[model samples]
Each structure stands twice: as C-alpha cells, then as structure tokens.
Target: MSVLIEVVTDVAADPGVVFDLELDVDMHTASLRGSGERATTGSGRRRLQLGDEVTFHARHLGLPWRMTSRVTAYDRPHRFVDEQTRGPFRSLHHEHLFAALPGGTRMTDRMSVTAPAGPLGAVVAHLVLAPYLRRLLRRRAAHVKQVAESAGGRR
Candidate 1:
C-alpha cells in the first residue's frame, strides 16, 4: 500500500528563494540534525538540479537507513519532484511546490511512500511511518522558513 502525505508552510520570503533553499543539501542536513541526516553521495553539500541524485544517510526508528533519490522534475520557483531509486521503503516520491503570496510564499510538499511486506506493510505505513514522516516534514519546513525569512529572500 502507498501512503500520501501533504504538508504546507508559509514563509516570509519570495518563492524563488524558498525554492532554492529546498534543494540545498546542506540546508536539508541542518534541518534534520535531530535525525542525524547527512548527504553522503551524489549532490551532497550542493544545490540540486534536474537529473541530480542525492543519497542520504540517517537514523530513523533507531536504525540506520540510506535512500538515494533523483530529481525527476524541475520547474524553477514553481515545483520539482524527487523519486527514490534505492531506499528502505518499497517506493518513495516527493514533490515540492511553491507559490507567490502577498506577504511571502506558500510551500507545499506532497510525499507518497510505499512500505514493503505486502498487506502488513500497509498497516505499518499507516500506523507508524506516515506520522513519523509528517513530523520530519514539518521540521524541515520550519527550518526552511526560518532561513528564508532571515536571509531576506536571497539565496
């Protein structure tokens, strides 16, 4: 079974700035400091572009995990998508959308995740993974908001 998670955040910055920050690996790692997430391969420590791939290493649920994702879609300052090529889950797809707002920008993240183990995976995904991922996404959004607001909408 696949789980869909959607998150929205308002930032005091331009859509372009928020969009670029979202693709910065260093910013991502910093935002996930609690989980010890780090970019280990591919576009680590850099801004990602279309077709760029990044492998992340992190500790989740008390276990180490690695996921490699590639940027499959790109629309500067608007939207982008990344899908897992290799990961712990059966499949993972993350889409990020940005829109200009009167005061700032509205950022939305839509993630689809599928766990392994046939029927049992669906249960686990609903009961555990979904909530956990939601929190992580919230944390990431908060961090981005803070940075974008502080940087005055500049990259």
Candidate 2:
C-alpha cells in the first residue's frame, strides 16, 4: 500500500516568496539540518525548476540514504511536483501547493510513498514511515514558516 502524508502551513509572506523558498536548495538543506540532508548532485546551490533533478544524501533512522528526484511539474507561485527516480522506496511522489492569502500565503505538502518488500514493506510504511515522514515534513514546514516570516526573508 502507498502511504500518503499531507501537511499545511500558513506563512506571513507572499506566495511568490514562499514558492521561491520552497525551490531553494540551500533553504531545503538548512531546514532539514537535523537529518543532515544535503544535495549531492544536480541543482545544489540554486533553485530547482521544471525538468530539473536533484540527488539528496541524508542520514535518516540512523542510516545513510540517497534519493534522486526530478521536478515533473511546475507552475510558479502556485504548484509543483517531484517524483523520485531512484530511492529506497518503490515510489515517492511529492506535490507542493501554494495559495495567496490576504495577509500571507498558505503552503501545503502532499506526499505518497510506496515501499518495497511486498506486505512487510506495506506494514512498515504504514506503521513506521508514515509517522516519521509526517514529523519530518512538519519540522521542515515550521522552518520555512519561521524563515518566511522573518524580515530578512522578504523578497
């Protein structure tokens, strides 16, 4: 079974700012500092765009992991999608949505992950991966919100 996770965050920044931050490789690496996540290939220092691919190396669950994802869809300041081309999981899809609010922006993340190893993988994905990923996403979102709301974050 594929596990789906969704998180919503409201930021006191413009939708354009939020969208640009979301695609910033440096910002993503900084946000996941606890995981030691960093881009190893493809777009590293610059922002990712449609048709761009990035390989990320990170330590997760006390193990080193690598994943390569390609941006398959992109609509500036609105929506984007990335799908894993290679990773531990059988499949991973992430969608980012941004909506402009009167005062700021609303950002939403939706992810679907399918593990390998048949039934055992499904059990692990539902019981273990789901919660872990949820927390990870939450932490990342909080970091983005904190950054976007700061005066220095304005573009």
Q: What is the C-alpha lDDT of each candidate?
A: 0.94, 0.90
Which residues of candidate 1, in runs, are more than 4 Å off? 43-45
**lDDT tens per residue, model 2, 101-135:** 87888899999999999999999999999999999
| Candidate 1 worst ten-residue window by lDDT | 36-45
- TM-scores, all candidates, are 0.96, 0.94
Q: Write the per-residue lDDT of candidate 1 for residues 48-96, one digit (tens) a residue.
A: 9999999999999999999999999999999999999999999999999
Evaluate residue 139 in candidate 1 and report its C-alpha lDDT on the 0 to 100 scale.
96
Clashing pairs in 1: none
